[model samples]
Target: MNQHFIRNIEVKKVRHHKNFSIHIDDTYPKHVIFTGKNGSGKTSLLEGVKSFLELFDQYSIPALSEWRDMVRYNEKSLNEADPSNVYLTDQFRNQITFFSDQIDQFCKKVELDIKNAHEIHHLLEEGKFLIAYFNATRTSSMLTPNGVEKVSLTKKYPIQRGAGDVFIKYLVDLKTQAMFARQEGDLDTANRLDEWFSYIEYNLKYIFENDDLTLHFDYKNYNFLILEPNKEPYDLTRLSSGFSSIFSILAELIMRMESSRTNLYDVEGIVIIDEIEAHLHVSLQKKIFKFLTDFFPKVQFIISTHSPFVLSSVNDAIIYDLYEKESYEDFSNYSYEAIVEDFLGVDQYSSIVKDNLTEYENLINKSSSLTQEEEEKVQKISTYLDNAPDAHSNELKLKKSYIDLKRILREDTI
Candidate 1:
């Protein structure tokens, strides 16, 4: 089923800096949602869809030049401050070098649009589609050039030459003695590297079978808890920075959906989730948008959110509202009704559902028991935020300020 479609996207001077453009309506409810705030430019519009998913290798080329140095930043004074100012352009300029020195040693010249830079780099190099930048390197850490501080991914493919570095060195030596018995801490080599990373995440992608594959992870106590009977390892910094940001966004969307499967929708990819309701838990941000609407329904998700439960159970998602445009070095001539009234006139979706329903009713009254259907769904969201009123309208004032932020998380658990 090898599919892909991203219709439109544009960003410039990158991070928080705008010369923005966004258009997507590739028909049907393919489901996509993105609201904004924390450094708007929502992950620099997911680094222009991971630089259009590294022009289709779907990830390779040092994982798209280490995700274009994570939403590009490096303008050694815009090439020594405007060295004849050509900057960077590709929309099919051909000599295709969209700027680098590993993104100029960390995010610099991220502004684009030179009169539609040769027709948006020839429609993102003819939409082989690729773009997925997320959580802007949350707490920035990545090391492994043998310095090994944390950036882990080298069973081999960081480069050893071809066949995807010989199948990542034969799957790290067929799971290198269970990935060094769980990185040498051992508990039966970390339960055989957590059951061979859950059998390469349930036998790598759909050769067919369907039940939409299932497994978003929370394996009740992890280090990779392969059926945690009592092994207790999950200390990726004591899980819960919203479960280590949903295990670093489900390990970068299951290794970019199991390295471009080569066919079934042959890696056309597009994922732009920024602040996708960060540090989630409005039921794991509604199970991360119902696991990206039924696990990558032919991938093409654009997200930037301030959350109205990630924009009311998104359908064919599209809503923009970025402001500021004094005199175009950029916020790209702002207009779309001043970007949806600068995010619904700073109501910002009722303060992102009153700060995620006060952290989802304080993680369900500090979870010890709940089952009677999460106590009648926290008593019908505490009787509709104690009988709504305060001039409610911005979607019922974000559903009664997320039901009085889940009744101040059940009054701080009484």
Candidate 2:
């Protein structure tokens, strides 16, 4: 496959911006991560890219009518006769031109043109160059049986409404495909399906370290079951939120990769995941990127995350911290603390704990002797630190800080 990357993208009057430009290809990382506070236009930027890709696939340009309706409100230019006219002369117009030229260049580079539209369509149908988008507002409610009903491959899959529905359907489809393959004496295809299932099981076990729990598919009922080491198997509905979330994401990704005739380790395509850290623990967030990179080495993952753990885990990814605008910042070498404070705009430790520590320090500085109130506050902080969960490495540093503060208090008393 020809190497294709979005060289640059510029937008104006899109949402909250007069002009915004991002040059991705110039500092091309293996993957890209979007991080920002809420209402920071991260999702808008992702949607813009998605729109461009879809329009390019259809050989269509951004229509002026669509822009007029979609463009950001011109609050400053209310006096203008037509606010939409401003878009035609500003960065929005330039962005349209840029997208058009880039799409043409990319098509030529990939040997896709008007004459090869049929070929492009075939490739897209086969899931080649797939652009998978996972919306943030996914629900983890029970996967209804109707959601897993056999879908015709001849038709496009329905847009997933529930969080786990798409994954459940994919799992059911795989089982169906495997059974059909076996009946047709296609052992290789059946075996591949089995292999994929085993891969999922292996990774789940590795991550969870629950040797007793194993993933099982019930061919009889077309349902997924979780089998304990010695206990009776349970339905997927009984699984924990974390397990369900992880399994759903991994299953969907594996299915997409397989559709393109790519193995777990060799899948190549673009995957856009909004709120990638949703429902994931810090430990899982740290491992998720590593696992994804190992599983889908060639895949271009564009993710929007709010977790410092996720940002810190990835070293070779381009991190775009979108606040007022989007800009590529190399966060591969940044420490977790730096990532939290600088990119995430927050302290590494809890604000409550930091405040207590600051107050304790202030009291200690004001007088050489420790008062009853100051001593009680220090003791309270020390107790809090002692009781705090050490799920993260930063917690250890916090614990040390508490110890040092106690030691200083002791010295002051002496």
Candidate 3:
């Protein structure tokens, strides 16, 4: 039998702090969700997982070159003939090359005796062992042996042969603009690009109208089209942000699922999604959360979100608290997914929180009669909203929803 586990995550010499760790027990669910305030190291923690995997695949060396003192350059103290003096840049470059060679030598000595059969399995458990990262920073071009070149969609490119990515460039294009154009010495490829553009222009009308999604691709090169798959193109501005965000997420999840299935029982696989609820509608948020339960049922999913709508759909999760104290002290808090599971189970509670947030939005927009006690509580929640950050609007919305639910529950007792 094959088994997979994350084991643990540890960080060092990173942006946030000197050190931090997250330990997961076997009690973790196959589908996991993580909720925390912004800047709570959620993305950083997820990056740890990706970084570790990249190390195993030898793709992370460039990013981590500084850590190993691999950068070598000239030293002014010694002459050029002797090992005395060298130019700073040359010394830095030479040291990096030496370190890389040393590390490769070390790996050869150590890797042979160990087994890594579970590496692939663990990663695929979360969908597609080949990590497909989607964030705002991804660019339109990636360096290749030939030089920087335009990326293609609809067909695979030679430069992307070793990289196991399918469709990330399309997601990036969702927020940007993409059009087919001819490149030097490649009219056929340009024509192919034109065909893809024509197809996208004709078939993706609905997505364009919604203006909520961005598409990306990882083919001959990386490209973002700022479009989604649709039957017809609509005015990009009219589409709902929530809908488009969910569309981007769902598309990626589905693609990953299909890819993961090709290899079953592999270890060292995981899917890390940052801000899983970005720019999505409330209803779509809830639906997407629920839908994810079905999409990658066996894969381990680690998603970060500030949206309560995203929280309500999770059956099990690890909640990390990033609150701080005034005396320059740092501490963190955690809650099991079970607490969230039970909290969202009440009928009034679930109904108000689970559905696409339109219902709650309508309720908030309408007036409601309240008793003295009920009125006082709603007032308190509203007041709390005054001090909350703008990024926490969803948290406030959830707070208000609970207040309304409490009011209804209290009236039932009377």
Which of the numbered candidates is closest to the native, going by highest TM-score?
2
Which tens-of-lDDT digit does each residue in 173-237 have in candidate 3?
Answer: 32123233343555666665455544444424333344544333433443334444664433222
User: What's the CA error at residue 347 for candidate 1, in Å?
Assistant: 7.4
Query: In model 3, how large is the Cα lDDT of residue 167?
Result: 35
- For candidate 2, the lDDT comes to 0.61
- Which pairs of residues collide in candidate 2? none
lDDT (C-alpha) at residue 355 in model 3: 40
> Which 10-residue window in model 3 sums to the lowest lDDT?
325-334
Residue 275 displacement (Å), model 2: 0.6
Per-residue lDDT tens digits of candidate 1, residues 1-414? 323455455555565555555554434324345454445555555555555444333222344455455434343323334344454422212222344443432334232212212232233344433344555334212111221122223211111011221222223333545556666677676685566555455632221123234333332221222222334433233444655554454444444434443423234445555666577666555446655555556665666666555554544455554433211112224432343345434542356445545544664646376678777766765555455442344554555567557656776876
TM for every model, in the order presented, reads 0.26, 0.67, 0.42
| Predictions in order: lDDT | 0.44, 0.61, 0.43
Counting clashing residue pairs in each candidate, in order, gives: 34, 0, 65
The prediction achieving the highest lDDT against the true structure is 2
**Residues 177-272, model 2: lDDT tens digits:** 888899999999999988888877777776666766687777767678877776677876665666566555565555555544545446445667
- Give each prediction's root-mean-square deviation over alpha carbons: 19.8, 8.5, 14.2
- Segments in model 1 whose C-alpha atoms lie over 4 Å from true places: 1-49, 52-248, 253-281, 286-303, 308-321, 324-386, 389-414
Give candidate 2 regions above 4 Å deviation. 26-29, 60-122, 139-151, 154-190, 206-212, 230-232, 237-240, 262-267, 324-335, 367-414
lDDT of 2 at 198: 84
